[model samples]
Target: MEDLLRPIYQERASDRDTLGILLIEKTRPNSPLTDDFDVILLIIVEDNEDQPWHVKHYEFDDKTAALHVVTEELLMQWIDTSSYRRAVEWVIYGKVIFDRNEYISDLKEQLRSFPSVKRDLRKAIEFGKLVKSYSEAKDLYETLHFKDAYSRMINSLHYLARLAVIEKGFHPEVTVWQQVRYIDPEVYKLYEELTESNEDIEKRVQLMILAIDFVISTRARYSAKHLLDTMGEREGSWSYSELKTHPYLLSYGLDLTAIVSYLAEKNIIKTERVETKGVGVYQRKYLVTDKE
Candidate 1:
């Protein structure tokens, strides 16, 4: 394996920005999990104020390699947001071929720590996505777009599994269903109901929607506490535009308005109307209350 990987490592090392290299070997034969690649190499580079990363593929002497160039900043973002579960798995399972000042090892340690704040923030973000997808699915169903609603429900189930894993203080892995099945069977049952139930298509969709609604009502406040905390960071209330552009929240691709509305409905947060300069001009702002 080293003989096959050495040349690739040498090639990447020529780039001055290269900081570390991780080599993940395929141990199972004909396994779909490997994505049909013999080797997966992650080349980590310093933030050079350029594009985050790129991919390269190679085939030589009957060997296949998938090369991924990732910036350290982007890597940390993936870790914090749980966006790149496969990359995180590679970090844990791959062998470090080379490192500049142990940067790779340190990153692995950081992931191992699994800080509470990061965990909570990621869970909140995932839950927010779950709610958004569920809402979209319901809208599609009401419009008689049954197929589209089914697809959206599947997306919602994916987010639900991720949220469940994050709730247990673990980074979600690539096989989210497998992980959720063992860790949180209640959440797993929702997936089963959507996919494997014997009910009619519309009935299944309705049941799944109802299940998701219950989850949103019970879990939204606790799962979204991080977002609420960000809103309370300032003494004054935050406008819709302000929260929409918040740097941290931006990473999650959240529907700020939907989240704010959900919290308002739950009475966990209150909205106030602030008048603008023009006559009858007003904007809505949100803030967490002491009762919340």
Candidate 2:
């Protein structure tokens, strides 16, 4: 492997005359020789099966100038095709490693896993673009629950997103969810609810309808438990603080204390804490007395 790669290393190190001949002679196995070492290396990476497919041209260049010159075209090809998978795996494995106090070992693992995801992602994006040409992916539900018929369409969008990540070297796992929230918060919320409930298609659809109605009617001011109760009855009352403590509230980001402060500031619902002489101070759940 080293001997096969030695020529490429030597070509860059040797003068333009000798380097040019060797690169050209090497291309006799193929066709269309040119002055560009860039073309030569590309062919080598693509056509040379004995060498690893994912090897970057810069591995030969230890200096900044040579590395930058050699990588100008090849880098873009890799970025366009393979970067997403590399970035994502880096984030996932990096996070897991740092969490375990084994950062060094994890870093080495990242170096290895990084290339596979890139190669896969590039292929995925190409596959996605081909699929997107024939179908449409207009919304979150289509991309999520109805992935069967629109699999290609969804894949295309995912691949495109991955491609962007690869180009930018960004890895935000919440990014996809944040995109859903922006595009369709109601639909996103419904998806979260249904996923948590583990309901079937019919149940999920029905729940989605209720969630839409909930978002439209009440401004999403109630806790999950209160939301369920309100859906069941169309009207109910409870104290703000007590609603926060409800067991189901974990499904949302709200905790008991934060819920009270938020509801009071928003004025979405009225609050009351009932103090009974024998029972002591008991906080009731918040009730939606009015809707604006």
Candidate 3:
């Protein structure tokens, strides 16, 4: 049974020119000859789900007549498995990773392309909209909607949310990774290196958000000293002690020094030394360069 099955899969793997569905029918393991063509499987690349779940089948058939006749552009309908249901759920729930309203609105457009599923797709869309609204309204790390929607969809949604967390620079937690894996295990395997514990993830999220805010707020004024100083308050000038209190500086405590050095090296700022009489103290004052 393994010998016959392995060769067929290998043949399928090698045939890049033949794109579409591969129908494979195999006989029973116990009686390979009598049940020779008893099992049949339909393998089609699912456009909706990611690459791995692309293959789906329905019934089991084993017979010389049932060997998968392969080619591209041909779509396999189904065999015995709930591949269709899984595909539908993935599309509905995966939208949570992206903008929910926008995704559904586009889905409405995609459904129009396939006239057959358009009607059922619309009904799914109506329910999907409701689910999305609820998911978005909840606070970050606050709401967990795992049970309400279809299991496959919830799985996709959870993976998407964790991806958002990763993009925001906070590490995803093991539990978050688990949630994503429950939907698409492949994603977990792909991004396993970045995800961390919840506490670490929270800190990363805060840092990411803060960095973005800092960049936006400092666009007009391109000085690190100014960027660091003005991030928290409206005051014009802050003492060195008062400046250290800013979270912006604390976030990159070590890099902050290097950034200042870089600015000086670039001649963006002029650094001067002043000597105080008796105290013999040196102070550096920064002035914006003409190039800035």
Candidate 4:
């Protein structure tokens, strides 16, 4: 496969702006890692204002190839925010075919280290999604939608499992449950109870709802550290819009309402009502609690 991909990456390497190139071969049939393509050619280039990435499908000497033209800036954003989950996989598993000043090599080392700031951001984002989905699941259960609640609970658990893995200072891998099974068997057991238990859908959903609530509360302060820290940076309380739109928080893509509500419910944060245009009305704002 390298024989076929050599000239392609060579052509890119010839460009002055091209920083590095990596080749990720599909390890097995029907694998989604490379989108089932025979191979993936990841060409990293210097930042450009035009766009973040340009993707192309090619038939290189009859072997299917997926070309990803990504800029250094966008790649960094993806790594920081976990915007594109596969970005980590690419950097971790890719075979470095070309390197300019060992950029790709250093990046791999950085990811292996998994700095606390990046991990905290990923945790906060995952926790927000967990709270949102878990809340929806409970609402569904209240409405007697057992099957729907079960499916939502599955998603919620997936987020929780990822959260557990992140808290342990590891990136969630393709087979996250496999990682969770070893990292935190307790969460893996929750997954098993939800999926493998012989109980009817309603009972299983009920059981998970209670368990996940406790888990969320347990991790609330820790998982919300990034957001709480950001809010604490400024003196006054932050309106929901301000908190959600802040540049630092933007990367997390937070489900702001859900996170804020859960934090208030668990007393991790406090909410205040400020006077609005209407004399008797008020707008809600959130702040880090004094003790937090």
Q: Assess candidate 4 and give its lDDT.
A: 0.89
Model 1 global lDDT (CA atoms, 0 to 1): 0.83
Off by over 4 Å in 4: 60-62
lDDT of 2: 0.37
What is the C-alpha lDDT profile of model 2 across 1-292, one tens digit per residue? 2344456545544433111111212233332232223222222111223333343443333321011122223433434344333323322332121122343345345544455434333333333342232233324344454544233333434433333333333432325556555554544554466456666654554444444334322422322224334323446665544444554343232233433444455565565666667567765556566652
Local distance difference test, per candidate? Answer: 0.83, 0.37, 0.36, 0.89
Query: How well is each residue in 1-292 modelled by candidate 1, as lDDT tens digits?
Result: 6787788788777777888898887888864435678888899998656579788898878878888889988988888876776788888888998888888899888777778889878877887788788889999999988889999999999998998888887788878899999999999999998899998788889888888899878888788878887877878888877888888688555566677778888888888889999899888888787536
Clash pairs of candidate 1? none
* lDDT value, residue 10 of candidate 1: 89
lDDT of 4 at 131: 96
| Alpha-carbon runs more than 4 Å astray in model 1 | 11-17, 29-34, 49-51, 277-281
- In terms of lDDT, the best-performing candidate is 4
Query: By descending TM-score, how would the candidates be arranged?
Result: 4, 1, 2, 3
Candidates ranked, most accurate by lDDT first: 4, 1, 2, 3
- Model 4 worst lDDT window (10 residues): 248-257
Candidate 3 error regions (>4 Å): 1-243, 277-279
